[model samples]
Target: MTRTLSIAIKENIYRELRKLVGVGKISAFANRAIEKGLGELEKEQKREKEQLRQQLIEGYQKRTKNKELQKTLQVYGEIPNERNEYSLSMVGLPLTTDDLKKFLPVEVYIENTPTTGLDKPSKILCDSPFTWNKGIRFKKRLGVVSKEIIEKVKRT
Candidate 1:
């Protein structure tokens, strides 16, 4: 057996319901709304996450660039003479022998000779890491080398 009941709704609410139903079935309309809302929320969340990631990367780059620039600047000031070769003591910049080789010329040797002092000599030395010596030749030469270029080269 089946039974039917009639119910009354406010005029405005009834009009709105009728309009919605006219566009599509109630179930279909509700489902579409739910799907669209969820999709929009997801897209918004993804965009936020991407933005946060970009911000973090940019912050890290800025910080590292600043540190590299500072190191390069300190070394730039201490350009060594022929007698006083550039040493790690000039600046606290952390660089490997390979890095120096890649950035500088092949003639530059990492001098391991101990200097007479209480301060232990550094493992790596350069005839002129910042400036090229007369004997040294570079495969590629930059017109003007700066701390920024050094940092960028190292990053690559």
Candidate 2:
């Protein structure tokens, strides 16, 4: 269900927005921009909450009963049911660099930080740097190359 919303803003700002996104797109542009701003604010709040959770986990690990944690896990409310004893790790997907590299050619280098691996510089046997996706665009070709590299490494 959708309801029409009416709100007022500065005339100059509204004019500028109209010029940028056009009148027909103002509602959608405003919605996306507002939601992105809200998402950033929520990310900071979540970061703080995660920090506190980490501290609690650290404190629990320091306990002498950390070794014999069956009853301790129960006391900490970690035992979810009669069978389960602990919580699972939350996964942020699309593979970490360390893991993803295993699927790629070793001659190719990947940027270590802020991992959009496809945007980073890499090379084939120190030939020249290129973007992961565009530079080394041949996945099928690289698979053969990678296997050869592995076989050579194993023999040596």
Candidate 3:
């Protein structure tokens, strides 16, 4: 099931997104972006919550070790987090956008046959991943070393 939603973006960003995804796939591209962002936020929230719980536990134990605060805190329902206790019941979430752009491949696939008067070559910022890091020249140098190692092992 899908619902219609409208959003406004800057003209330049919209143009860039269209070039990256397609003319009419803005909605799908936005959805994929949001989903990926949400996954990262969830993991970060989990990590922060665990860190906070540990801090609270440490604070409570330090207070209790004094002997006087221990009896006082015990009188009230509030206690240390040592018994696997947490104050936060609801999940709330909230990194690196720069590193992603550095390594990830940005590509566009052409499948349909070219139509007359509609196709033009566009200047792209980076070489296509399929061409950039492929073929004999780009293949691992480790292959030669591995072959030498294998030959040596066979002799032994």
Candidate 4:
């Protein structure tokens, strides 16, 4: 049985297909390609379904019994979930040469201690000989800065 069907395809792909397979045989080539693609899709779906079924069976086999559940509950009532917060509470301390030596090559936020006449705190990369004074307090920066920002800071 033969049925006429019209479909839209990309010009480049259509041109290639027409060049490879003549207009008279285009329908046959497309039919074979679609059947092969559908077969592969069906196989993939079956594989996924079997994988999910195996996981379900394994889950059922490993499920804890009522007694084991009760024992776990007794040992730890309403267990708290794991916390993943990465924030640190760092207190600012007066900047000293000793601290600069202690935490060498660390990124720090240096704040002017009112007497330095500086406008705002600056993020600094403490690789070598840092300019320090009695009127400066420093804290380690919690987050990372971009390479561009680092370069800009270095330029100044």
Highest-TM-score candidate? 3
Worst 10 residues of 1 by lDDT: 133-142
Could you tell which candidate, 1 or 4, scores higher by lDDT?
4
TM-score of 2: 0.38
- lDDT by residue (tens digit), candidate 3, 15-45: 9999999988989999999999999999999
lDDT of 3 at 89: 21
lDDT of 3: 0.40
lDDT of 2 by residue, 7-80 (tens): 99999999999999998999999889888999999999989876766676556556535454313111010111
Candidate closest to the true structure, highest lDDT: 4
lDDT scores of the candidates, listed in order: 0.40, 0.42, 0.40, 0.45
Weakest 10 consecutive residues of candidate 2 by summed lDDT: 71-80
- Best-first order by TM-score: 3, 4, 2, 1
lDDT of 1: 0.40
Clashing residue pairs, backbone N/CA/C < 3 A, model 4: none
Model 1 TM: 0.33
Q: What does candidate 1's lDDT look like per residue over 54-126, in tens digits? A: 6755554565534443232211212323443322122212223344334344222223223211122122223
Query: Any runs in candidate 2 off by more than 4 Å, and if so which?
Result: 62-156
